[model samples]
Target: MSMRVLKSTGAAFVMQNMRTCVNKPIYKETFDVNSLKKICDMLVVSAQQRKLVRLAICPQVTQHQIWTGALMEILNQLEIEMCVKDCMKGSNMAQQIVVNCLRFLDDVVSYDPDSTSWMRVAPKKDADSSPSAKWSDLLEMFNDLINCLKNDHEFLFYVIKLEIMKEGLSQIKDVLVDKNIGYKEALHQQSLVHKKLTKSLGHSSRCLFTLLLYYLYGSIQDIELDICWYSEDVSGNKLYLCVGKIIASDEDKMLMHIFKQLDRALGVIKFVHEMAEMKEILEIQGHLWCIGSKNRSFAYRGHNFFIHGISLE
Candidate 1:
């Protein structure tokens, strides 16, 4: 063959070969906001149905893993949406994503206490066998979503605060009033608290609701006490008085100002009693009562401590 003809023929062959072996650009999977919302909605429905089945008939099914996987996928997509800073910002889909994430976590916590440790919730067996699931990635995803909670997502914040307050009220309801003691009245009071807390999304209103939460759940670690701890140890009646007093005091008004002041006053009284107990402890060690001395220093110190702690609170 002629050199020119051979070169042209070779070039044509090479071009054909290149065309045959052309590499298509690999596209990464991307989901838009609507797609994400739809995914989360379907997953939520599936999880709910699974929970019902697990609760009703078959308790041994491997359901949490399925639920967790769905949650992980949703969160990963949401994180990407958050990073992209596009049309998803402050959208209803974003809010729904957060709310659904929290609801999933709450469901997990409620169903599988073992899953509370996010780092290890994914089955370890999958690590040695399957290459698909990584619990560590799930943990990272969870942490990312959790950190997002502190952002200026007003709806997200409101939902989280409302959930916390509702959980606190649920805890306190039993402690405050049970079947034997005005259960109907207790339900009514809880309904009122719920109504009040859900009324306004204002910061001050949120603060007031959160204050009620703190009174119910906040620890008096300085005094080494809390409502739950006290309720568990002492009679329910006294603790009931402390919690129910606010609802009882202003059943008609249900004013935040009145409840807040009452809550603080009760806290002070509680600390004062706690101080007296500490003074007794000192007395037991012969610090308060000496052989030939009548120094009321312990009482004075207890009173001062009570006053200082209340002021600090």
Candidate 2:
């Protein structure tokens, strides 16, 4: 079929199928990966032609010709299976599939939040040219792309990591470990409680950092080359504070394990502290670890103090 004919017919078919699915439960399941791929493929082609698929897909709409939420769920599942599990990482068409799926997601999610779902049925216009014209939903789409693309290349991972940090930090800064949580007890308490509290509040940065930490900490055997890429924003501060806390608290095994995984990236932490002008704070924290190393002497205000020293001064 000519691309134009396919785009028109495919969009019409999707609308009709979506309408039928509203009344029939079986039709809901019918919009599986293959069905979604067909729709997404047509949307991708249409996008190339500067014609986006604009159908009402939100909850309040009466016609209910599309279910964007369900569509996103399917995409999430396929993403996990294909990208996360690396099942289709080697497939020739996997990248295209991912690109189309994400493009369609951006399309549906790009609907003006202020507009009613019914308004989505309007004819396509200049607003549909870019997949991310409406940036309110940008991260929701970018996150999936990041997860899908990160494992593919270090430079790509670095790029997406920076973007995520910018967006995630701006929108969900509270879920971030407080930069002041530099003390061991504070860090420990925060780690134990932040996950549950953040989940209850419907935030994501906590989970994102927790998972990233898990990956970094667990990579004791084969750390990636771009491990240093995480040394900025949410990841960098959280980790720096985390390491300082762990070291201060005498988490000997964990400290050693994390250090091993971090390898040479430890320098990045130093650089990060320098950039933040928190070098003095890092030096002070370093003393917590040095307490066990050896005796040290320092003179302060005409008084001499030594490591493990007891003095009235």
Query: In TM-score terms, which candidate is top?
Result: 1
- Write the residue-wise lDDT of candidate 1 on 1-313 in tens digits: 4534433443333334334221221111111111112212212224444333223211111122332333343345445545565454455544455555555454332433333333432334444663432223324333444454546563363334433333323322322212112335434443443343333222123223233223333421111111110111123223211111101122224334333433443443333234223212111000111122222322222222111001101
**Prediction RMSDs, each to the true structure:** 31.2, 27.2
- For candidate 1, give the lDDT of residue 311: 10
Q: Give residue 296's lDDT in candidate 2 (0 to 100).
A: 53
Clashing pairs in 2: none
TM-score of each: 0.23, 0.20
Per-residue C-alpha lDDT of model 2 across residues 1-313, encoded as one tens digit per residue: 4534433443333335334322211121112111112222311223322111112111111111122232344345545555544554653354555566557545433534533333233234376554322223444444555554556653353334435334322343333222222234333433433333223221123223222232323211222211011122333233212111112222457445434433323332333234233313331111112223343543332323222211111
Where is the poorest 10-residue window by lDDT in model 1?
281-290
